[model samples]
Target: MNLLHAYVSGRVQGVYFRGWTRGHAQRLGLHGWVRNLRDGRVEVLASGPDNALRELQELLYEGPALSRVDGVEIVAMADEEQPTHGFSIAPTV
Candidate 1:
């Protein structure tokens, strides 16, 4: 299993990025959450098979066609400890 945390920048807010991310993550059978950061970025944490996680990250770049994703910063999350079950959209932070 693999877990990843991704922060998507550039016009990510107010564009359904979080919702879209949740759908994609769910489709990929990933667990974790997505939320809007105060700094106007979409923050997502996804855990699943390595291949699925990679596919989900790639999908984030397009982002429901309404988003203008300029950059994506990803890092491995090793402290989660426990596995996630399903994807969700979290309240803005």
Candidate 2:
């Protein structure tokens, strides 16, 4: 399994980014949560098989058809951990 944390930046918020992310993650059988950051980026933490995790990152680039993702910063989470039961759109922190 692979765990990843990504920050997707651009015109991402208020454009169904979180919703699309959750839906896509669910479809890809990934587990984690996505939320909007106060700084206008969308942050996501996902854990799954390596392929699934990599696919999720690709989806973040063209989020929601409404989003304009300028860039994404991805980091591998060294500590392997199982995520929650399902993907979700977490409340902004």
Q: Estimate each model's TM-score.
A: 0.91, 0.92
Which segments of candidate 2 are over 4 A away from where they belong? 80-82
Model 1, runs deviating above 4 Å: none
Q: What TM-score does model 2 achieve against the real structure?
A: 0.92
Native-structure RMSD, model 1? 1.3
- For residues 1-93, write the lDDT of model 2, one tens digit per residue: 678799999999999999889888999998899999999999999988889888998888888877899999997666745585889888897
Q: Which candidate wins on lDDT?
A: 2
Clash count, one per candidate: 0, 0
Compose the digit string of candidate 1's lDDT tens values, residues 1-80.
77888899999888888888888888888888999999998888888888998899898888877789999999766765
